[model samples]
Target: METTSPHYRHTKIIATLGPATQTRERLTALTLAGVDLFRLNMAHGSVQWVAEIVALIREISAEVEREVAVMIDVKGPEIRTGDLPEPVVLTPGDQIHLFTTNATAPAPTDVLSVSVNYPDLPSDVAVGSTILVDSGLMRLKVLNKDATSVRCQVMTAGTLGSRRHINLPGVEVNLPSLTEKDEADLIAGIDAGIDFVALSFVRKADDIFALRKFLDDRGSPARIIAKIEEQSGVRNMDEIIRAADAIMVARGDLGIEIDYHCLPLVQTQLVQACQDQGKPVIIATHLLESMIQSPIPTRAEISDVSNAVREQADAVMLSGETTTGAYPLESVEVLKNIIQSIEPSVSSDLNSRIKLIEPKEKMLRSTARLAQDLGDSGIVVFTRSGFLAYVLGALRPRGVPIFAFTDNESIFRQLLLPWGVEPFLIDFSADPEETIQDAFERLKEKGWCVPGSWLVVITNALANDKVIDTTQIRQVE
Candidate 1:
C-alpha cells in the first residue's frame, strides 16, 4: 500500500519511540509513513534519553520538512508493585499479602507476598475491594487490610512479575497527582520544548488544573493532554474534558479499572464528548499489538483502528506496536493504510455531532453548512489561536477540506490533532484582508484552491479594536 502521502487522511497517527524505532533511520521511516506525532514515555526512560529523542525527532522533522509534534508522556501517580525474585504463579484459592515499601525487600518465601510503592494502599483499600495487577492479567480480592498490610485472595490466577502496575478499582488511593519523578521530568520536557505533555492516570479536573498551573508558573506553553485511565476520570469526564487541552483514551489502565466489556461504549462516549467540546481525543494502547512481533497486523486490529476513525477520534496511537515492534515501519504503514481506507467513508457520512456548547459554535456550524451547500468550495480559516479551526473540525463538514492558516507554530501543530483540518504556518499579518489574500494565494499555489473557485473564509474581523466572528464568501481571482 502507498503509505507515504497521508494528506488524504485527516485522522493522525501517534507512534511511540523506543528500542525498535529509536534510530534516525527508523524514525524517519515512521514520519514518512504518516506518523504525525511521536510520544516519549517517561515511565521507562531517563531525562537524557528523552532529550535525545526530542533532538532526533526535530532533526528528522526538519529533514522531512514536516513539523511533526513531540509529546512527553509523564508517569503520574501510578501504583506499581515492588520487585519480585521471580514470576510467582498464583492459584485461585491462594492467599497473598501486599504491603508498602520504598526499597526492594528480601524475597518472601514464607507467603506469596508483594509490596506497592504507594504507602497508603493498605489504608485506602478495604475488604472486598478488587486488586488488579499487570494490566489486569492477574486479579486478587482484598479479604483484609491494615495500615501495614493488605491481605488478598487470588481470584484470577496468573504469573505475577516484578514492578508491574497495580490497580485498585473503586478505591481511591491517596497519592499526589504529580509524583516527584514527574515534576523532574516535566521540567526536562519543558526545557526540551515539547509540544504536548500527557498526564497519566488523570482522575479529575483538578489534576489538569494543577498541571496547568505548573506550566503557567514556569511560563511554558506546552499543552496538557489528560489521560483517562481510571474510573473516577470516566465518571468526571465532562469536567476533565473542559479542563484539558486534549485527551488520551488510555485504555490499558482503563480496561483494568472498569469492566472490559464496557470499554467500547466508554470509548465512544469519550470520543463524542471530546468532539462536542472541540477537544482532540486520542484512542491509544493495543491498537495493533500483533504487529509487535509479526510483520502484519491481525484483521481484528485493523478493524479496531478503523472503528476509532469512524468514531471521529482525532488520532489512534500505537504504543508497544511501534515502540518495541520488530516491524515498526510496517506498523506505521499498516495503520496509515487502514486510516486511508476508512477515512473516506467516515468523511462521506460525517454529520454534525458537535453540540452547540457555546454561541460561537452555532456560527461555526452555520459556516460549515454554507461550505457544504456550495459543494465546490473549501473552507479557509485564518486564526492566531486556532480556535476557529478547531470548532470547524469538530463540526465535521463532509466533502470540504479546512485549510487553516496561523502565525503561531504551536497552534499549527495543535491543529493537526483535529480531523479534516490542515494547518499552515505563515507570517503574521496585521491586516485581516491581507492575511486572507495571502492565504488564498498560498492555497492556490498548493493546488488546494484554484482561480475562480469559491471559498468560505472565516476569521475574526478587526473593527474598533474588537474582534468578532466573520465569515465571508469570496471567489479566488
Candidate 2:
C-alpha cells in the first residue's frame, strides 16, 4: 500500500474501524487512502475483536513501511433508561409522567416508567430542568419533583427505544466518569500498546488527574484525552484543557447539553482555546453525516469538514460513517478528498493571530519564531497535555515542521488531525536532557534533520510537570 499523498502533507485523517470495515483488505485500502490514524471505539465491540483490529493495523503499517497510530476510545459515563417493549413515541403538549414506581401507559397520557440506577435521581432533578433522551430525540420538561419520581411533560415528539441515552442539563448526575468496563478496556488498550485513550464526558481537571494516577499505579501510562461534551466541561474548559493530554470536541452530547444553534460558536471557541494553549484538538461527530448511507457527502458536510481543516484542527474524524455506515470505504475516500482539497487554503500566517503573554509564553513563542526564522528543520515540543505543540502550530510558522513528543499515547494519536504536527509516543523519562537528545537522534535517523542543522526544543524542565521552564535552540551535531 502506498501511504504517501501530496494532499496529506499538511493534514491527517482518522478513520474508525468497526463491523462495516474490519477486514484486512478494507483496512489496507483505508491506509492507502491516506488515513494517518485508526480509532478503535471500545464502546462498541468486544476486547478480543478490538485487539484483532489493532494487530491487523500494526501488521499493515509494517508491511507498507508507513507509521500509523491507533487510538482506543473508552466508553465514558453514560446514563440511560432500561428496556422498552417497542419504540415509544411522544407528542408535544402531552403529559409524560416519568416515575420510579411501576406504571403503564394507556389514558390519553404519555407516562412511562423509567428505571434509573441512581437511587437519588428524583431528588437531584429540579422542576423546569430539561431531560434529553437519545440525543434529543425526545425532550421532557420537569413538571414536579418528588423523593423517587419526577412528573414531566413531553416537549418534543419522537420514538425512543430500549436503553436510550438520557441527558440532564444543569443537573449533576452523580456517576463515576470511568466505569469498571472502561477500566478493563483501558488495561487492554495499554497492553496492546495502543497509542491513545480517550476519556468521555470529562467534567473537571480532577478526573484527568485521577485517571493519570490510575495509569501510573498500574505501571501503564497512556495519554488521557478529555472529551468535552457537557456544560460543566465548557465552564471548566481552561482547567480541563490544561489537565488532559488532548481535547476532543464531542458535538453529539454537546448538542444535548447546550442548544444546537450554539454548537458552531462552541466549536470555534474550543478549537481556538486549544490552539492558544498548544494542545491538540479533535473535531468529532457527524463530520460526514450524509455519507453514512450515501456514497458521497452533502455540500454542508463538505463545508463543515473544510472549516475544521481551515481552523487547523489536528484531525477530523468520522464516527459511524466509517464504522457501521453503508458506505464505509466511500466515506473514507470522500473525507480524504475534502481534507486534501481544503488543506492548501489554510493560512500559514496564523502566528500573527496568536496572542502572546509574558515570561513562559513569550519565551516559548520567541523560540518557535526563531526556529521558523532560522529555517530549522523541525520544532520539538515536549508536552504533557499537548498545549505547547498546539500553540506552536497555531503560530503557523512556515518551513519548520512541529514534532510533538509526549508520554501520553492519547495525545500522540489525537494529534493526527492538526496541521504540521506529527505526534510520537515515547516511554516516560525523568530527564529532560535525555529526552531532548533522544528526540534529536530520532529526527536525524528519520532524515528529518542532519548534523549541524538547527533545532528548537521547548519543554517544562520537570518531567510530568505542566510548568514550562526551559526553551533551548540547539545546533544538531
Candidate 3:
C-alpha cells in the first residue's frame, strides 16, 4: 500500500535536470521531495552529458535506496530557424525570403531574409502558406516561392532568436522521426540503461513503430512514450495510442499548432483516448511554468494542475520549472501538493473507462473491488514480468494502493510511471508462500501495515510442478 513513507501519491511527478539539479546533492533533495522520475531532455544536453547524469542519478538512487526511473526525451524531427549572428526583428508587412541552408541570397532585394535549417522548407510550403516562428509568436505569410527560397510577408511582429522552433500548422512534416542526433542520443540513453524513451513531436504511428524497431533491434527494454504535439498527430491519435507504450500531451507546440481556443477540448480528448486504451498519458509543458522564477504559482496554474489531476492523468511533468528554474524543489512540492489535494475530490472507474479485454485484467479489477469492500485493505501483487501490476494499475482502482513486488530490477524501475503503483524490488524464493511472507515482512518493516491490517494478495502458487492462480485476503500477524 502507498503510505506516506516510501511511496504513496496517486499522481506521479517527473522533473527535468539542468544547472539547478546538476549536482548529486540537489538531485537527492528532489528525489526526497517526491519526484518519482527524472527526465533528460536531449534537446539541451549532449550525449556525454546524458551518460554522466544517468550515472549520477543512479549513484544518488543507490544512496537513497529508492527506485527512481530515468527517461530520455529525443528531439524528434523538429523544425527550427538556422543560427543567426544576431536576433532578426520582424514587423508587420515586412518582406523576408527564407532561403535553403546552402542557397544563395536572392539578388539583394529590399527584402530581409534568413537561412532555414531545413532545405525542404522551400518545397513543403506554397504561396499564401503561413509559417510560425518562435512558438507562434511571429507569423509569416508566403507571398512567392523559388527553387531556393520562399519569400513571405510578415503577418505578426516579433524577434526570432537563433534555432527558434518553427511550426507549420495543417502541414505534414516530411522528416524522419528520429534524426541522426536523436539516434546518437538514444544510443547514449540505451547504454545508460534508461527506463523510458519519449519521442518529441510524434506525427503518426509509424514514428513510434520506427523508434520501437530501432530499440528492439538494440535489445533495449525501454518503453516508448509518444509525444503528440502537431496537428497531424492529433488527427492520427488512435493509431499512435495503439502503437505507443504511453502518451504525452505536449501542450506547448499543441497550443500553437491548433486553435488555442480549442486546446482544452483537445486535451480532454487526448486524456480520454488514453484512458479508453488503457495507456498511461502524461500532461506536460508550462505546468507551473511561472514557478521557475517565483516560489508561488498563479491561481490559474493551480487550477490547471487541479484539472489534470481530476482528469486522472498517469503523471504530470515539469519542464523549465525544474531544469532552469530557481525553485526546483518548491516546484516538485507544489505539484505533489496539488495532486494530493485534488485526488480525494474526484472518482473514476477504470473498468468503465477501459474495456477489460484480458482475463487477467478482469480478475484484477475484481481484486480491486474486493480490497475496497474490506476497509483499510491494500492490494499486494508479486509479479515476475510486472504484467499483473501494470494491468491492475491501468484498471485505476481507487482507495487501494497497489504494492507491486518484483524481483526483476528493470521491472521495478519501469513500474514507476503507472498510476497508484508503488513498486519494490525483492528476491523471490522457490516457494510461493515464502515469497508472500517476505513481502509481508517488508510491509511490516516499512510500518505500512499493523498487526491486523488487511491485504488482498494476488500470486501464482507452485503446486505439483504446476502453477495455480490464487487470490486471497490475509490478515497481518
Among these predictions, the greatest TM-score belongs to 3
Q: Give the TM-score of candidate 1.
A: 0.92
Candidate 2: what lDDT?
Answer: 0.76
Per-structure clash totals for the candidates:
0, 12, 0
Pairwise TM-score winner, candidates 1 and 3: 3
What's the distance in Å from true for residue 326, model 1? 1.5
Alpha-carbon deviation at 82 in model 3, angstroms: 2.0
The regions of model 2 sitting more than 4 angstroms off are 1-8, 100-111, 350-391, 398-400, 403-418, 423-477
Give the C-alpha lDDT of model 1: 0.84
The number of residue pairs in model 1 that clash at the backbone is: 0
The Cα local distance difference test for each model comes to: 0.84, 0.76, 0.87
Between candidates 1 and 2, which one is better according to TM-score? 1
For 1-477, candidate 3 gives per-residue lDDT tens digits of 233233356788999889898798899999878789899999898999999999999998989887699999998887787777898788998888788877975544677667777878878898998999899999999998888888889999998778888899988978899999999999999999999999998889999999999999999999999999989999999999999989999999999999999998999999999888888899999999999899989999999999998888889999999899999999998998888778867774544778777677788888988887785678999987777887787777766788999988888998999888888899999888898899999988877787788899998876798987778899988
Span of 10 residues, lowest total lDDT, candidate 1: 1-10
**Ten-residue stretch with the least lDDT total in model 3:** 1-10
- The TM-score that candidate 2 achieves is 0.80
